[model samples]
Target: SQQGEEDPQALSIQEGENATMNCSYKTSINNLQWYRQNSGRGLVHLILIRSNEREKHSGRLRVTLDTSKKSSSLLITASRAADTASYFCARAPQGGSEKLVFGKGTKLTVNP
Candidate 1:
């Protein structure tokens, strides 16, 4: 496999607290994207920080990249019950394919 799966299949946090998650993958990549999925809603594009970029932030979402370590982290500041969902990291491979192969995802449950 060209991609490595993320550890900690699930996470739970209290409302108003921050949540952090990590992902690691093997091989080279052009870009990695983070997505969020609610119970009924489809995958919503959260953020995309390229391999060369170190970090990017959006409202409550913050993403960091470490190419040397082949890993990335996501921090949600002051999470809410609305934030309860599954988060996934996907990569657009270095070469050959154009589709993003997604990880199994980390299920995040925020208690209100």
Candidate 2:
């Protein structure tokens, strides 16, 4: 079974605004990762936060995880048309295989 599912499914925002996407999962996780995919391109690693960590930030991105709620969220600050893409959440199961289960993803459009 899939371990993670992203919320909202889609988001549209104007440039300079912030975009937020959420994810919920079942079962324990070793870590959770957020990925972005541009149209007709492969997924790119965005950020990864471990189960022991509550939050992490990199560049214009911020991520938070709440194991108690089995949920996580990704925040993209200062929206730009270049930031428009599909964002996915993937989880690495605790003591499970190396593979990460991915959600359907949330499509974000940043208008200029």
Candidate 3:
């Protein structure tokens, strides 16, 4: 079974709004990463938060991890139409190899 599961399968919002997505994991992890995928395009690594880190930010993106709850969230501020994409959360196990397990993803649509 998959380790991470994202909530709210889809989201729609106007440009300039903030978008939030959540993910829950089934087991302990070394780190949690978020990725963005555009239609017909490949995935882009967004952010990665280590198990010991509570939150992290880059550009307009913010990521939070709660190991005790086995959950995480991604926040994108000042959304743009270009930000429309599918976002996934990936899990890197505590003692596993570099391979990562990914969630189903949350499709976000930013309208103009």
Best by TM-score: 2
Q: Quick one: RMSD of model 1?
A: 1.2
Tell me the spans in candidate 1 whose CA falls farther than 4 Å from its real position.
none
Q: On residues 40-82, what C-alpha lDDT tens digit does candidate 1 reach at each position? A: 8899999998878999999999999898999988899999999
Q: What is the C-alpha RMSD of each candidate to the true structure, in Å?
A: 1.2, 0.8, 0.9
Question: What lDDT is reached at residue 79 by model 2?
Answer: 88
| C-alpha lDDT values of all predictions | 0.89, 0.95, 0.95
Question: lDDT tens digits, residues 5-108, model 3?
Answer: 99889999999999999999988999999999999999999899999999999999999999999999999999999999999999998887678999999999
| Model 2 bad stretches (over 4 Å) | none
Per-model TM-score on C-alpha atoms: 0.93, 0.97, 0.96
Worst 10 residues of 1 by lDDT: 1-10
Question: Which pairs clash in the backbone of model 1?
Answer: none
Instruction: Please list all clashing residue pairs in model 2, or write none if there are none.
Output: none
Q: lDDT for model 1, on a 0 to 1 scale?
A: 0.89
